[model samples]
Target: MASEGGFFSAVWETIKTIFWALIIAGVFRTVFYQPFWIPSGSMKDTLLIGDFLFVNKMAYGYSYASCPSIRLQRFGIDVDAQDICFFLDGDNTRLFGDEPERGDVVVFRHPSTGQDYIKRLVGLPGETVQMIDGVLHINGEPVQLEDGGQFVETYERQGPEGRPPRCENGAVGPGADCIKSRQIETLPGGSSHSILNIGDYRGADDTGVFNVPEGHYFMMGDNRDNSLDSRFPASAGGVGYVPFENLIGRADRIMFSSAGRSMLFFWTWRSDRYFKAIE
Candidate 1:
């Protein structure tokens, strides 16, 4: 009887420790940082698929969405989609952190879909944004564009057009006949990032003026022609002008990245991306 009681005591202690640890971690995640896993290539090149990073929760103050509710449903605490939509989807967002600036890589709730999205802030509130022949035009003036250089990409997975690396040009990678054109785009606020243009001419490359209304922002992906960004109207399956309240927090850096291979395949890890600061 004594031996059995000791075993039970040990197990109970272990459970208590685990419970306290989870509570502390939950508090930290809700108050300081929130981890996000990149499952898509929308922010490609800058942020790759399988990348894991933390969004600084305090970088933009706190919202109910960040108040331990984004994942509360998993903890048996339900969060309604309607409340998230009403509070986080548009001008309803309230924060005590600094206002968003141009060039910050932001994560936010998608207004229409209620899903989270990550993209670069290209246009600020009340700025006229347009794209002309692949050039980013802000307020009728073109931002500086520089030749970023070109490189052949070898894809590990089959993408569009049977290319291992699918590019904006509709997939053609690794073998003969891969798209090799890309550029470095500098935002008007003096931030530089790379962009890829696959030979395919998607209308996003040449879009008309978009007058960013007050309290709203414009977002885009570094992948250029392949991204469904503010350049495309929301009705056309793109994340059109994002509102300020919808902004979550900026992505500060990449914690690490994998190539969609099993975590056990340690060799598939992109170690160089560990702790890489976002541009």
Candidate 2:
């Protein structure tokens, strides 16, 4: 009888400890840093398909309107940790911790579906952005490109005669047998990044000469022709324009990356991408 009672007591204590730990973690993640798993390749080359990341939740101030509310613990430990929640510590209740600069990578809620998306900021407010003949221009100035890689070399497509032909990165698609070209882009405010041109031309190639309205953001994907972003109109159920209120925190770093299968229990993990800072 004594032995049985001791075993039961130990189990009970273990369960209680686990319950408290979970509750504490939940509260912190809600108000501070939260983990997010990359669900798609929309931000590919910057954020990979199977990357696990930590988003700075407090980087943007929280509103009861954004996340669902929950009960707080009574007599909870007041762990006054600044690193845990940075924005709340400062007097500036400005929705964002720091004013988003040009070329900074950000994660925000999709205006159309309320789903989260991670993309680089290309055009800033009050700036004129347009794509011309496979080049990105900020205020009519062309952006520069950097050495991305040789992935474009292996790319192939169909020839005019319908045979497999060597392709370029900007060749437009299977129908266009030219190497698709891209350029390193520098935003007007002096930030540099890259843009891809798939050779598939659209009217948008010469679009967006309008001045960006105040508090509105214009964003596009690094994949250029593949992304359905602010370039598309709202009637298409795609991201046309992003409002300030819909902005979430910026993506700071990659906590983990996996290419094959994402079984957490697997002992072998891809260590190369762990703790990598997002460019």
Best by the TM-score measure: 1
Clashes of 1: 1
Per residue, candidate 1 scores C-alpha lDDT tens digits across 51-156 of: 7899987777766556544446667876644464445433455668577878888988676775778988989888899888888899999988888777355555
Q: Mind sharing the TM-score for model 2?
A: 0.68
lDDT for predicted candidate 1 compared with the true structure: 0.74
In model 1, which range of ten residues has the least summed lDDT?
155-164
Which parts of model 2 are misplaced by more than 4 Å?
A: 1-19, 64-97, 146-149, 152-183, 201-203, 261-271
Model 2 agreement with the true structure over 122-174: per-residue lDDT tens digits: 77778887777656777888776565543242223211222332334334555
| RMSD to true structure for each model, in Å | 3.8, 8.9
Assess candidate 1 and give its TM-score to the true structure: 0.83
- Could you tell me how far off, in angstroms, the CA of residue 204 lies in candidate 2 after the best superposition? 4.0
lDDT for 214 (candidate 2): 72
